[model samples]
Target: MVERQEQAASDAVMTRIGQSVMLHHAGDREEARGRLLDLWTEIGEDGDPLHRCTLAHYMADTQDDPADELAWDLRALSAAEELTADRPAGHEDASAARALYPSLHLNLAADYAKLGRREAARTHLRRARTAAAALDTDTYGAGIRTAIRRLETRLGENDPDDPRSGPPRQRS
Candidate 1:
């Protein structure tokens, strides 16, 4: 009964968050972030890590500096790591939670690049690629492809003549 009640509460939270997402997509960032913060507070400490990570990302995206973005990305990555660690050994493939790792890598890479840490940026890009490869193919496969392409573009290894938009992916 308690589990069901908790699930219901979670559902309500997700519903409200979905509304916030809609607001965010419509350019009402301030409103969305405000609602998001309210929801974050409601979720409490033991709430879902994914939601927390998402809130962090949203907070950063709505911020000014790219370093602020990196901060949120790092927090999300830490949450993903914690989620992975908490999973039992047998079902160690709790990938939906871990998908945040690659995003963190990408964000960190971008930050390093902005700060002129070329080697560090490349290293972070590679780390992102590695994290992406470990993701579940059935779900995050497309995201992994996107991340690889983005990393390739960042590394300047991509051909300028390539038709690809954002990133160039070297398919394995």
Candidate 2:
């Protein structure tokens, strides 16, 4: 009975999150951010790890500043780590958290790159690539892989030590 109740609560939270995501996609970013912030307050800092991870992941997207986005993404990654640590291997939640690692690392890589932390970005990019092997070959997975490749190419093009690489180009 307790398990069922917990599942119900999780489902409710996910539904609300989905609705907010839709609002974001529909161009009501401020409204969506407000809704997500409300949900975060409701969930609290020590809420269920899965819920926290999911919420923080989406919350990162709604941020206006890159630094804020990085902070939220870091929160999401921390929650995912907690979720994986709390669950047994092969548990559904553990598996789900593992699945999130690639994207989380990828986002971190991009954030680090934006901040001109090339070595940090490279480290996260490698982690992302290694974790990406777990991703399925679906459109979402393909998109991430493509983004990783693009970022790698861009990073390679901006080697500060290599004068031949030239000045950093503007991000598209």
For each candidate, give its TM-score against the true structure.
0.72, 0.87
Task: Name every residue pair that clashes in candidate 1.
Answer: 149-167
Please give the distance, in angstroms, between residue 130's alpha carbon in candidate 2 and its true position after superposition: 0.5
**Per-structure clash totals for the candidates:** 1, 0
Task: Give the Cα error of residue 140 in candidate 2, in Å.
Answer: 2.2
For residues 7-57, write the lDDT of model 1, one tens digit per residue.
Answer: 787678767878888888899988887887787688665667756666665
Error of 1 at 43 (Å): 3.4
C-alpha root-mean-square deviation, each candidate: 5.5, 5.5
Full-model lDDT for every candidate: 0.70, 0.87
Query: Candidate 2, residues 1-172: lDDT per residue as tens digits?
Result: 9999989989999999999999999999999999999999999999988888989999989999888988998999999999998889799988988988988998988888888898888888888878887799999788887787777787773434435446766766
Q: What TM-score does candidate 2 reach?
A: 0.87
- What candidate 1 gets wrong by more than 4 Å, as runs, is 44-47, 89-93, 135-140, 157-172
